[model samples]
Target: MTERQHTDQALIARIDPAALLERTRSWSAINSGTHNLHGLTHMAALLADAFAVLPGELSLVDGDAAESVGADGAITRLEHGRHLRLVVRPDAPVQMLFTGHMDTVYPVDHPFQTLAWRDANTLNGPGVADMKGGLSVLLEALRIIEAAGTPSLGYEVLINSDEETGSFSSARLIAEAACGKCAALTYEPALADGTLAGARGGTGNFSVVVRGRAAHAGRNPQDGRNAIVAASDVALRLFEARSPALAVNPARIDGGGPNNVVPDTAVLRVNFRPGDTGEIERARTLIGATTRAVAERHDVSVEVHGGFNRPPKPIDAGAARLFALVKDAGSAMSLDVAWRDTGGVCDGNNIAAAGVPVVDTMGVRGGAIHSTDEYLLVDSLAERAALSALTMSRIAEGALS
Candidate 1:
């Protein structure tokens, strides 16, 4: 091994695999769903204790209230947990940002709660890969850096509690922290083959409430408007709006009544992912037109909620350089790292929107994320942490440029 590889190994040696896996297991034991306030609070407290081992000013910031339209069509604030922020060296020459989410998609009622050994090298659980293990990797990398002594660069860490729900509450915080930083890293779990996500499409989740007049199906049915039919119109229009690069997923429809009655209310949920800003604007226009058309035809009141929350994450020149740095760092340890464009959006989109270069997936290699079969590779705990440690150490010493 090269002399620098030796130094990286010495630093990575501090990342004990057993300790990392144990920490991951402990974290995975907690059900910190995006909507589970109690679970999030518990997980946040544990994170505070674990991250305290590093040198920084750690604090929790409450997530901004998110607004959602209820069945009665009333917009209300959705409660969420506080976000964790830690600033290690604000005055250092080089600046970087690191981010991860404490929330998972699985709710408290979800059956996939416990971690079990799928095999000798794989552990399966609700969030073992997407991404309690990622946070473990971030903490381990930072621990190595702190042990190596003072860093030459400044860095900020933001572990938010609302990333799984579109990061609406912590969007401002992420943008504020990422602004003016030279580079950013988000631990969002890499593919089992080690390929990180590259340029991403934008995602917009919309809820269309269709309200119409109800009447008895047996009497004067023509006098009443059907909300379910109206919602179906809107769904069809949304489906027709799909383009070659744009995807439209009609997720669910809520509010239906007995077959004898013409339903008065129906809610249609549609999710769209656009390839770029052009597609985003066009999508918004098409959605507005489609909803208006359907509501007018069915004589129903339509209220649309939600929009493109996460903009596309395009890999610009600066982001490419950041990717190159990670590639080089991985190469140093004989780990070939690569990336490909993805339609999935994450906090990396918001950070990249702030004009900061970001390599979003620096976490452990895993598969079947957001599913009951989600599994984390046992050895990736140390392997990914080592890659991150080398990358961070290089950035701190200004060797990345």
Candidate 2:
């Protein structure tokens, strides 16, 4: 083997699968759900301790308070957990960003809180695949890279606490870190078969509040403006706005009172996935037009909250080069790396929107994320870590220019 191949093998050999699995198990045991403040605090502390092994300045950043429209049509502040940030060699010529999340979809009250061995090769549990395992792999890869003493590349690590809930609290932080970076890597978990997500569509979440005059249904039904009816009409109109480029889902509606009284308040919660910028514009136009017509016809006041936080991530030349570099690294390790377009959106979308080339799924191979059946391929712990280490090493060597 050539000297370079020998050096790569030596770095890969330092990755210990058993230690990675142990870390994943311990991290997943904590209930760091998006809304679980206490759990997230605990998880953040643990992460800070684990990531302290790296050579950098680490800090716990307080997230901005997020806003939410309540069922009573009142806007309220939603608190999120603190995020972990680590910066190393910031003055270096080549800088990169590495990001992951500590929060899972499963809340503290969720029953699937324990981990189990599906077999000798698979492990299942909360946040195992969708991304506690990914976080472990990321830390190991960075540790290996640091051990190799590559002085050409500097990187910043951002582990936010609110990614599963649209990253509202940490969006600005992500944008700041992504600025002026040559590339980014996000550990959102690859598919079970080791395939990564390519060009991802953008996502928006909206809450529409409808207010109407309430009156006794039996005594003055005609005099009362029905807010429930108006809300339903808005939902239908938004649903019809769905097209080939945009997917609209009106997830839920909250409002209504006793059967004897006309409802005075209703809130519609909807999500929109736009394939491109044009579709995002179309979605906004549809929302404005539909809400205006519904309000006029029902004599109600309409309010819209929320917006398209994640922009669509297309495969630009820079992104294509990053993917090719990753694929080549995987091939060097006798692994086949492939990606396909997906509708799912993550912090990667926000990072790519900042004009940074990012290959976001540099995590473990797993399936059934955001569900109770989520599992991680046990062997991928070392495999993916090695892949990321080699990829970063190549970037340090100026292979991505």
Candidate 3:
């Protein structure tokens, strides 16, 4: 056998599937929802302890405060859980970034809070596939590489607490860690059939708050401007802005009052997805024009909060090279690694915005993410870990130019 084949066999043998599953189960049991501070703190501590086995400087970095417009048309500060960062061999020539999130879409009060085996090889639960399993895979891969002796590559591992809701708090930190890296890998679950995400569309969220004079419904009603009507108009105009390259979703409007009173406030929550950089600019322009026109037509004051946090990630030359490297590594292990464009956005978009090429779905093979039906293909734990280990080793050996 060739030297590379022998090395691959040794690394694959060291990954224990049972251990990886157990770690995922234990982490999934905790309700580390994006807004569950207590749960997030507890989960963060456990992750730090688990990742401490690696050779690096590990620290829980405080999260930045995020602002959200409330139902009452008030902007409030939101506190997020701390992010875990580990840097090893910072001075090494070939540096890379690996990131995953600890948060799941299931809130603390959500009913999907436990795990069960759907079958002999399928385990289902919240966050199990969407990322606790991915975390386990990442750690196991790193462990195998370390056991092989000192690695020639340097990498930074970032496990942040806010991703399901958007990586606002950890975005700056992600960009900072991505600086000067040769490539990046993010552990968002891959499709059950092992399909990865290729070029991804960008996403933006906005809350448009409208203010008007309040008046009694039975008397002087004409003296007051209807904020709810104005907000609804804004939503419709924004929805009409959708095109082949841009998708607009006006999700919720939070305002209205009892009869006999004209409601004076309304907040519209909307999301936008742009297919490319030009589309992103068009989306912004649409928002500005729509809000201004609505305000003028309805005679009400309008305020827009939020912008596109994730920029569109088109496959550049660097990203294409990284994907080719991953495909070659998967082929060596008899795995067919393929990808297609997805409308879903993740930290991958943010990292790519920093000019770093990233293969984001380097995690367990799973499906039904963002829902209670999420399941992880139990066998993929070791399978994907070995794939990652081999890929990183190839890069360390100067396989990519």
Candidate 4:
């Protein structure tokens, strides 16, 4: 191994994996799904309490007025309940931020809310792999950074109560906090095989509502426009628009009644993903044109809702540098660290879109996210925490660019 690789590996080996495992296990026991406001509050309070023990200032940033940027570039604040932010040494100008969400996709009464040990090195539970485990890693990483030595690189930790629901109510707040930061680390879990996600496709959800005249099927069928048929045609057109890099999926169709009546209203819920902005705009144009054409043909009024929620997170120079730092840190622990671009979207997309450089997959390694089988590798807790600590250390020492 090269001299730098050897030294990094030595530093990584010094981190205690056992302590990380215990902490993750304890945290995995909590249930904090998106709609579970009470659970999220409890988790936020727990995080606030945990960070309170650290030698830094902790303040809870209100995420209530977070704005949602629409497809047409219009912004509106969405009410998403409540959120929290804890800053350690917030006044430092050169700041590094760590972000994670306490809310999981599961609801409060989900059957998978409990955690159990699959083996000596694996723990299974709701949200364990999706993010609660990552939260533990963040806390431990902070502890290690403090133990290593205090450097003047300022840092803040933002733990939101709503992320599993697409950050509808916290995006603006996240953007505000992330602005002006030199770099960011988000605790989204790495792939089960330990691969990081380097780039992510742009994501958006859309709904087309069609209004038509309803009539009795037997008496005045010709008088009705049959909005359901128009919506079906639209759905098929959307599905046929898929290409190698872009896909359109008609997720759901609503508003159908008795068979004896011509349906007057229909709703089509669709989702699309494009590799970049150009493709996103192209897809949007196509969708808009198609919807208009279909509505005109059926003589029905059409309304569209939901648009690009987050922009694509492309690989920028800042992200590349962060990856190199993380790779070097992983090598110190005898691990091979690499990442690939994915079509999946996350809060990382929002932060990157806000022009902040981010290293997103700084959480535990695991698989089966958003499923009952969600599990996190116990070893990655310490491994990732150590990597984060070292990265923060290097940033403080000015060894990282």
* lDDT of candidate 1 over 1-401, digit per residue (tens): 77887888788778888889999999999999999999999999999999999887999998677898776556789888999999988888888899999999999999888889988999999899999999999999888888887468788999999999999899999999997788899999999998999999889999899899889999889978999899999998889879876889888888877888998988888999988888888988988999899878889999999989999989899998889889998998788889999989999999988999999999999999999999999899999999998888888777655
| Model 2 lDDT tens row, 1-401 | 98769878988989988889999999999999999999999999999999999998999999788998998989989999999999999998889999999999998899999999999999999999889999999999999888988888899999999999999999999999998899999999999889999999999999999999899999999999999899999999999879989999999999998999999999999999999999999999999999999999999999999999999999999999999999998998999999999999999999999999999999999999988899999999999999999999888888877
Superposed Cα RMSD, model 2: 0.9
Better of 1 and 3 by lDDT: 3
- Poorest lDDT segment (10 consecutive residues) of candidate 2: 2-11
Cα TM-score per model: 0.96, 0.99, 0.98, 0.90
Which consecutive 10 residues in model 1 have the weakest lDDT in total?
65-74
lDDT of 3 by residue, 1-401 (tens): 99989988988888888889899999999999999999999999999999999998999998678998899899889889999999998987789899999998989899999899999999999999989999999999998888887567899999999998898899999999999999999999999999999999999999999998799898899998889999999999999979989999999999989977898999999999999999888988988999899999999999999999999999999999999999999998999899999999999999999999999999999999988899999999989999899998888788775
Q: Sorted by TM-score, highest first, which candidate order results?
A: 2, 3, 1, 4
Report the CA-based lDDT of candidate 2 relative to the real structure. Answer: 0.94
Supply candidate 4's per-residue lDDT for 101. Answer: 88
Q: Which scores higher on TM-score, 1 or 3?
A: 3
Identify the candidate with maximal lDDT: 2
Off by over 4 Å in 3: none
**Clash tally, candidates in order:** 0, 0, 0, 2
Question: What local lDDT does model 1 show for residue 104?
Answer: 99
* TM-score of candidate 2 relative to the true fold: 0.99
Instruction: List where candidate 2 sits over 4 angstroms from the true fold.
Output: none
Error at 46, model 1, angstroms: 0.5
Model 1 TM-score (2 dp) = 0.96
